[model samples]
Target: MVSKLKSANASAAGQITSRSPRQIAWRRFRRNKVGMVSAGISIVVLMLSLFAPVVCKILGINPDELNLDLIDSSGIPTLPNGGISWEHPLGLTPGIGRDLLANLLYGSRISFLVAFLTTGLAIFIGLIVGIVGGYFRGRIDDYLGRFTDFLLAFPAFFMIVALSEPMVARIQETGIAQGNGARVIFLIFFLSFFGWPGFSRLVRSQVLSLRERDFVTAAQAMGASRKRIIFKELMPNLWAPVIVVVSLSLPGYLAAEAVFSFLGIGIQPPATTWGILLDNARRFVTVYPNFFLITAGSLVLVVLAFNLVGDALRDALDPRSER
Candidate 1:
C-alpha cells in the first residue's frame, strides 16, 4: 500500500511539472477578470492605433491636416461641446482644429513605439551591466553599484528636460534625423539613461541568487568559459522577472513621454500625442471642459489598462503562488 501510494504521488508530481511555466501563467492570467478586461482594452487600443491610417481613411479625416475653418476666432471649436458631431465623433481639437479621434489613434502608436524602444534599450543595458556585476564580484561589482547609486541619486528628470533641446539640436546637426525623428531619438536616449539602474539592480540580485546554484558550480567545475556559463547557464532563468518588469515599466515610460510632451519638450510640433493634446486643452478647461476631459480620460484609461495588465503578469508569474 505504501509503495503504491508513493508511485501515485510521483506520477501526479510529474504530470503537474509537465505543464510549462508559460502555460501555467497563461492559465492564471486568463482567470483574472480585471486582467482579462485590461488585456482586452489594451489589445483594442493597440489594434486601433495599428490600423489608424485605415480608420482615418474610413472616417474621411486626415490627422495631419489643420482645419482652420473648424476653429472660431477665439481659438475654440465652432460646434458645441468642443466640436463633437457626427462627422467628428470625438470632436475637433480646440484651437488646433485637427480630428481628435484621429490624433488619439495616431498618438497611441507613437507613445507605444517610444515606450517599446526605450524599454528595449534600457533592458539590454541593464542585462549586460547586471550580468557582469553579478557574475564577477568584488571591485567590479562595487564600482558598478556605486555608479548605479550615483545615477539614482541624481535629479535625472530635470536633467532630461534641460538636455532635450540641446540634444535634439545636436542630433539634427549630425543630419542623422530631422523634425520629429530627432526629438524622438533624443527622448529615447535620455529615458533609457534614467530607466536602467533599477532593472539592473533587480537583475543583479536575481543573478546573485542564481549563480550559487548547483548548475553554475558544475559549469565552473567543467572548465566552461565565463561567457558560456553566464550566457547558457544563467540567462535562461532571467526571463520571468524581465517580462514582469517590462510590462510594469512600459506604462511608466509611456507616461513619461506624455509628460515631456505636455512640457513642450517631447516629440516637438506637428506631432500630435496624448500629452500635446492635454497641454492644448488645459487652457480651455474653463470654457470647454469637454476637450480636456476627453484628452485626459483617454490617457488615464490606457495607462490604467496597462498597469492592470502589469499587475496580472506579476501575479501570474509569482513563484510562491500556485495559481
Candidate 2:
C-alpha cells in the first residue's frame, strides 16, 4: 500500500511540474468570465473581418460596386421608403449606393490590419531599443534615453496632419504608394512611428530593475554571451509585462487609425474604413441615422471589447492578484 501511494504521488508531481507557464497563464485567463467573453467576441470579429471576401461572395454583394439604379433623383438610396431587401440587409449608402454590410466587413479588415501591424511594429522597435539600452547602461543608455525624451516631447498628431498632403503628393510622384494601399501603408508608418516611445520607456524601466537580479547576475558571472543573457534569460521574464502592454495599446492604435481617417488624411474614399463611413454618413444624420449608428456602434464594440480584455489580462497576469 505504501509503495502504491508513493508511485501515485510521483506521477502527480511529474504532471504538475511539466505544465508550462503559458498553460498556467491560459488556465488563469479562462477562469475570468468577462475576459473569456471579450476574447471570444474579439476573435469572432477578427474572423469575420478576415473572411470578409468569402462572406461577400456568398452574399453576392460587392462593397465597392455602386448601384445607381437603387438611388433616387437626389442621389440618395431609397432605403427610407421601405426599399431595404434581403439582398442588402443593412440598406445602402445615400450618395454611393454601395452595400453597407459589405463595406462594413471589408472596412473592419482594414481597421484590424492597421491596428495589428502598427502594434506589432511598435513592439518590435520598443523591445530592441529598451533591451539594448537597459542592458548597456552607459553612454548608449544616455543617448537612447535622450532620444526617447525627445520623442515624448514631439507633437506627433499635428506633424502628421501638416505633412500628410505633401507626403502623399511625394509618394504619388514616386509611383509606389498608389491608391488606398499607399494610404494604408502611410497610416501604419505614421502611427507606429509615434507609438513606440511609451512602450520602450516601460520596457527600459523594467529591464533596469531586472538586470540587477540574482539570475541575471549569475548568468553574467557564468560567462553567458550578452545576446544569450538578454534574449534567453531576460526576455522570458519580460513576457508578462510585454503582454499587458500589448493588450492595452492595441485599442489605442485602432482608435488612432479611425481618427486619422475621420480627418480625411487616412485611407481615402472607395476604401471605406469605419472612420470614412462615419464621415460620409455624418451629413445625412437626420435623414438616415442608421448609417451613422451602425458604423459608430461597430467602432464602440471593438474598442470596448479590447479594453475589457486588456483589463482582464492585466488582472490575471498580476502576480499579486489572488484569483
RMSD of each: 3.2, 2.3
Q: lDDT for model 1, on a 0 to 1 scale?
A: 0.89
Residue 97, candidate 1: Cα error in Å is: 2.2
lDDT for every model?
A: 0.89, 0.86
Residue-wise C-alpha lDDT for candidate 1, range 213-294, written one tens digit per residue = 9999999999999989888999999998898888888889999999999999997667778888888889999988888999
Runs off by more than 4 Å, candidate 2: 1-19, 80-84
For candidate 2, the TM-score is: 0.91
Error of 1 at 144 (Å): 1.3
lDDT for 273 in candidate 2 is 86
Worst 10 residues of 1 by lDDT: 13-22
Task: Mark the 10 consecutive residues where model 2 has the least summed lDDT.
Answer: 75-84
- Sequence-dependent TM-score of model 1: 0.91
Q: How far off is model 2, as Cα RMSD?
A: 2.3
Count clashing residue pairs per candidate: 0, 0
